[model samples]
Target: MANSDMCNSVGASPGAIQAPPLPAFQPRSCFACRRRKVRCDRQSPCMSCTRNITDCVFPAPGRATRHGSTSAQTPKRKQAHLLSRLQRLESVVEILAAQVKGPAESGTLELDGAGLVGQGIGKEGRGSALDDKTARLGEELGLLVIDENGSVYIGNQFWAAFRDEINQIKQVFDNDDRQGDIYSAETSSLNGSIPSDLTRQRREDSLLFLFWQSRGQDVPLKDLHAFPSQLPIIWQIYIENVDHYSKMLHVPTFAKRIQDLQGDFSRMTPGMEALMFAITMSAINSMSNEDVKIKLHAEKSDLVARYRTGTEIALTLADFINTTELDVIQAFSIFLDTVQTMESPKYVWSVAGLLARVAVSAGLHRDGSNFPGMSPFNIEMRRRLWWNILFIDGRSGSDQIAEASLHEEMFDTKLPTNVNDTDLDPSMKVPPITRNAITDTTPILVRSEL
Candidate 1:
């Protein structure tokens, strides 16, 4: 009896027979709540899951925590990094929300295509939404400064965008064994040493070649011109990639004139000079830096900057604001096409406005049919130029700026005919019949219809 009573007392007080303690009760999140990254009540069907009408699924029970579990011993560095990342994500969301809400409140948001004007847009919505946002963000961040002379200082903010891009490129090359050597070679090339692969194809008469010859000196008038052997390639790229949709030039006629010029710029007018520079710049702008290095042995940035400068100088020489030259207007409009994507919207809009005013004074807003002595060819070309001016003005304007450069009722010039470029000639005495079928101007025509 004594032995039995002792055994029962020991069993009742037993530490040796006790079960191990489980982890603190972890409230199970339903699959929907977990997916949404929200807290969940440990119900069969969580509120979120029920509200969302999702399948209420619970994860299987996990093993209870053991000593020295990783969950309890996570490094402070990792936790800090995670918290920092979350904070950055929240900041980005806040900035984006502000951008969206600001535009909405002002009713000045401009979409990509300005073809749809006036469903309910207000008078204040005359400028580009992008321009408004750009101005707002730039001022707030101290990123952009516009001068009285219209020069924009955005170098600091411009490069800020490339921070992540450089890292991305570095990440791609990080795994390579030759990263140091690759970087060294790139550094050498950037330090004015020509790449070995590019040296063979480099020509003495190339535009970049000319730029190199005058690197630290004032370039002479003659040096601004080029007789590069790769003219055919640039022409090909322009006609296919650029002119296909723009329909700015009468390709067949312009090609013939260029062929006749035979790289001679001694007799070229200032307006013509600007147009040529714009053409080359636009072509180079369309190509990749690597591609340009391979073909022309020049830095793409250098080429573009030089030609853009040249275009500005030539326009100044032509007195674009006062002088009435068709070529000058054409050159300015084409340069706008190249820069509208890169330059400030305000600057582009300002220039586009000037172009429209000049165009109006030059009688481009009127149909050539209203003029009695205009040749058939001149009339057609004039129509093309007028429509192009209108389109460029529309493209550069904001959705909610003041009175835009273009208004539909302000011009009487008709849409360009859908006739092929080959059919129209500088010497054509009779007006060519318009075509019902698709032609060279079909792309422009389709856009015009819109």
Candidate 2:
């Protein structure tokens, strides 16, 4: 009777709903399991990947997978995300194609294959900013290129620069829209108002943090941050040997300018700071075992760390992105030459692009002789900077999408006269351009038809 009563009680209760049974035939195996030649639990990662601590990726739906079988196994959201990426790629290609075929007479673009275009501006627009912001964005994104005639275009190679790095960065940062909103707000506020005392403090703190992160800990922060009286010796070493390796800098001018600055790190510009550290590091690299490597208990490695730290700090402190100074270009040029790595080809490619854009923004790409108020010394400096950029581009290898931004054809700027900084005064009349072999000059002028 009890059994009968219990059976009746159980039957009276509602039956629990069960998930529908999975199909007896498996749709597809997980990638790892298939590769291992084993069966899968048909779970997202399956047991094998979970056991091995590996990522489990499945083929997208509506495609034939590794086993030669089409599976509608991908989630709806994933399919949508992939579709969005495809759309973006298509849109990018289309926009580039339009820009490439755009009317040439509509705007003036400096054709070093960097797409530095200016619209609605007259002849002066070529050097002055008309579309600098757009040009910078394209440069930063590695999307655009200009030809020898200042013709702009976009090509397949645009996406190739740092492609792996971009993917990895994307993985770490999924919500770009949110980040963009925050950035816009920050930028607007920064541009609209003078920074408060608190804001200044925050900035200082951030810079300090950056310095600390940049190898400041290898030695006393003060040692790394401040320029010492003895710093000139290291710079002297670098300047003397610089000509043997590079023609990007005018050694006499650079040395004299360093002397003029008089070891005041505080007064030094971002470009100067970058150049200082670059030279210091180069000097350290060039040192022999017999030479003294220790100063204030700081070894060569410590000094190197200091210079590297100082370079980054100075770059940020001087607002390198918005400001384009000749000093900064020289710094980047030297830094590029000093640092060697397996990843240099890709890294230097982007850097070369940046230096090119900076040169264009400064109007160094154009002939300055036409400008009425420009000094002879200033014109000579601009010419020197432009040619130096061309040399750097040659060494670093320009982006695959475009040739180096500063081309020989567009540059009508006269070559710098082969004269020492001390001999040529700013007040003196600028010398006429002459061939190097006829003048018996250094390899810098003699090697090329400048």
Candidate 3:
């Protein structure tokens, strides 16, 4: 009885000792109250949650404490959003990869027989809604630059850097190494399907015959010296306006070639005339001011007329597929860029492909070392012409057409030396050959890298 009395008396004073302060009632609100920012009413189920008929649960039961506050939840929400965007980006990449690797898989893509002008491969308006959103995301994420006109320009440097980061993310979703095999199969399928011998020969013969018939035998040769007075203006316009667009011709070399002709217009080959006219036309067409273009077009109407005429004459005179003249290739290359007869970009692309085919026919893809007694000057000129064709093909041909007639692996021509034309005087003991690294600075190194 004494022990029982002692135990009972020890805790007897604590019976009404404030019930341990009721956990201090620091307002640990329900989820609905916190999210909606309403008053919690300090109940087990808050007034806001009960009124909204929600679960009335707290995300963090001790959310009244600093560690469980809004500040602590912000980073988690942000992380979730970032994760969602990354997943979307991966989905876009997979679609594009499928398109590139296997065209048949891209059901939305409509391809022509030539496979040059496909609807969805690189063109707008044919992509899926997801693709459109991905393109918008590209702008938001800085993969593409959007101008005020809404034109998108892919930044190669940014792409190279971002590609590495995206590739890391790709590993999380895609583990298949079969993409390489798929791409290789696509390429082989393109290359493996060869025309029959008769078909190939017929095609070659037709192209040759077209060149043969284009030459108007009864047409009189237009005297180039008749316009010697206008030549200075043409040269000036070419240097100022057109040369930057395509740096295929060297001024000093052209000047030397002209001097060697000794002012005799009759001595100029048909190919040379075509080249001159093409340059003149390009300079006239590329005038920046609208008024100036109109005035120049009216004043140079004769010159404009001669551009097509001269190109036709050159093509007529040359043996075409059988001819191996570097000037013929050069003339056609500039002509492709200068011709305004066709407004479609695909026209220029197809013409550029034709020029590439002619170049390959001339063995320009091979090193000059294989040719016995080939001059260093001729070798350099071949290198220049080949690289220029590649540049044109890549820029004008691939960008719009999405098909390349010339493949880099099929060619082994070395890049021309980066020296200026005067420095490369071939007459002076075959000007000393100096090699540049593939990555070295050059006025036209993009084609070489490609």
lDDT of 1 by residue, 1-450 (tens): 999998888879847486554223323445676577554554667676777788877655553353434353133533453345446546544543343333333233232221211111222423544345434322222111112211111222233333433433343234233211111112222323466547432431232331232344355555665455767777887898788888888888778767777877766777778788778778888888898899778898888887776766566556566545667777877888888877778877877888888776665765554333356776787788788887777777745374755776565567888899988988888788999899988888776755
| TM-score (all chains, Cα) for each model | 0.51, 0.49, 0.46
Computed on alpha carbons, the lDDT of every model, listed in order, comes to 0.60, 0.52, 0.52
TM-score of model number 2: 0.49
Question: Model 2 shows how many backbone clashes?
Answer: 6
- Pairs that collide in candidate 2 are 111-150, 112-405, 113-146, 114-146, 271-327, 271-328
lDDT, residue 69, model 2: 27
Model 1 CA lDDT for position 45: 70
Clash pairs for candidate 1 = 125-399, 125-400, 126-400, 126-401, 127-398, 127-399, 127-400, 127-401, 128-398
How many Å off is the CA of 272 in candidate 1?
1.3
Worst 10-residue lDDT window, candidate 3: 178-187
Q: Which runs of model 3 end up more than 4 angstroms from their true locations?
A: 1-219, 223-226, 260-263, 288-297, 300-302, 340-342, 370-372, 399-404, 428-441, 446-450
Cα error, candidate 1, residue 370 (Å): 0.7
Q: Which candidate is the best by lDDT?
A: 1
